[model samples]
Target: MRVVILCGGESSERDVSLASGSSVARALLERGHDVVLVDPAAAVPVLAGPLRPGDVVDRIAVGKEPPSSSGRERLRSRMHAALTGGPVLELLRGAELVFLALHGGWGEDGHVQALLEMAGVRFTGAGSAACAAAWHKGRAQAVLGAAGVPVAERVLWRPAADEVPQGVKRLVAAGPVVAKPVADGSSVSVHRVDSLPQLAQLAAEVRSGEVEMLVEPFLPGREFTVAVIGDEVLPVVEIELTTPVFDYAAKYQPGAVSEVCPARIPAEFAGRMQELARRAHQALGFGSAAYSRTDFRCDPSGEPMCLETNALPGLTAGSLVPRAAAGAGWTYPDLIQRLVDLSTR
Candidate 1:
């Protein structure tokens, strides 16, 4: 299959997206697919590239520039049009499919999916509604919890004039809070709070734009994330952070920490986590569109608490999705192809 991989956006995950695009492109080529990596954020200057792996020929570098415009919706439209062209029309002019590597914000929150749906093009990951539900931590939590899935106790708050509610203040009374954006992924806007003052301060800073702050009591047990594909858990991945916390920097940055796959958790516990992950995915209306990964902080006794779902899990060179896919005996190329197949079907 001839494929175009879309990566790099104005989002904070642009760097990660570019790396993911490059790696996926290479992997696709190795699997005997003709692939080109394109920057969805590209406009003028006609960014060029020799993307994807397995090419005996030279490759083009992927380039993307941010939208320096007015509202996010407008930018989303522009990005949507660009993504349509960036893959089917521009990037993979002769290709048969596209591999989406976008992360965060509009990219994964259904904007891109909606755009692709309009274009009648095939890409990977969850649909627009599922993407929206999963991208927003608060919404996903509510939807999943209502469906009888176990999630953490958290107050999702959008600042009223940059102030947090008294209820939110009381929730973190005992100390150890995790302040994060209710609608963000890839650990962005996620903070660990040791005190009320710190949590309040962090909340104020994160409550910008339309982004709301999610204040929840911190779970201090082992951190594990389960990757679910086609109703099965690839493996449970345990995150080991050398630092006191695993922030955005720690997730994408090299040397921050190491991930242990097939996590050293009990078999029964791992199975339970996988079941919960699948239930969360389905409860959010994902319905086998593509795949998603569920995060958790489990207590030693084996009860796993849900964090959030990445309906469009990151595929960066060192991303958790790839790690899980690898454990499932599927190489990077195989994963990309599988995503395309799953989405198309």
Candidate 2:
């Protein structure tokens, strides 16, 4: 199949998306498919290597625009053009599927999928609704709980100027609360506040009301992630961050962390993690999704508690999902093809 990988949206996770795009492009080409890698941030990037990769290859990206004019419409035009319109639309021409490596807001949050769906094009990964729902941590947790999944006790506080201090008071009792922005991903602004003073300081910084934080008790345990593809739970990967929990830095950079597959946890605990992951996927209404990674923290008791569901897991080299997929004996392109197959509906 001809696969056009759309990657590198204008989100904080833009760099991670590029890495995913590079590896995905490599794998797809190796699997004997025409793969075009497009990085929107590197819009107008020059292709230095063989244009076709001996299979079919093209490097396409959006042209750089001034930040002042960089609205969603501006982005949509570039992305839509790359996938559908534009003169160098060679990437999308005759492409059977758009395997999205783009992460964060525009990509992972369902906007890109929604656009592709409207264009009547089939792409890999979750549909618009699932992408949006799972992108928001608090809402996804609630939905998962209603579906009978065990989640950590959490309280989401949408910040407001007048009641900011009061919200801090409520969050103070959570004890070692993890305060994080509601809609952001990759732990961009996540803060672990150990006391009320820290919470008050953070609340004051939410001056513009853009950052609504979710405060919850910090679960103490080993962190592991389960990757779900179709109905198959590949394997659990135990994330051991060099510093602390898996944050943005640890997730992308090498030497900062290690992920051990078939997590060293007991069999029962691993089974529960996989089960909760499956439930989270179903509850999110991810029809024909390629894959999702569910995060969990297991206490000393060996009981797993889900943190959140990642509708769009990283695909770059050394990413958790790809590592899990490889542990299942599927190479990069094999997993990419599988994801495309699942998205075919």
TM-score of each: 0.86, 0.86
Q: After superposition, how far is residue 82 of candidate 2 from its true place, in Å?
A: 5.5
Worst lDDT 10-window in candidate 1: 60-69
lDDT of 2 by residue, 1-345 (tens): 767777776776666776677777777777676666666545562122222446544333222221222354565566655555563354444568777888887798888778777777778888888999999888999999899988877777766655644545665765676778778766666777788777767777775655667777676678888999988998889987665455676665557787898778778877878888888888898654557888888655757788889888878767888889887888777887788778776
Where does candidate 2 stray beyond 4 Å? 40-51, 55-93, 165-168, 299-302
**Candidate 1 on 25-61: residue-level lDDT in tens?**
6777777776666665655412334434435533333
lDDT of candidates 1 onward, in order: 0.71, 0.73
Which candidate number maximizes lDDT?
A: 2
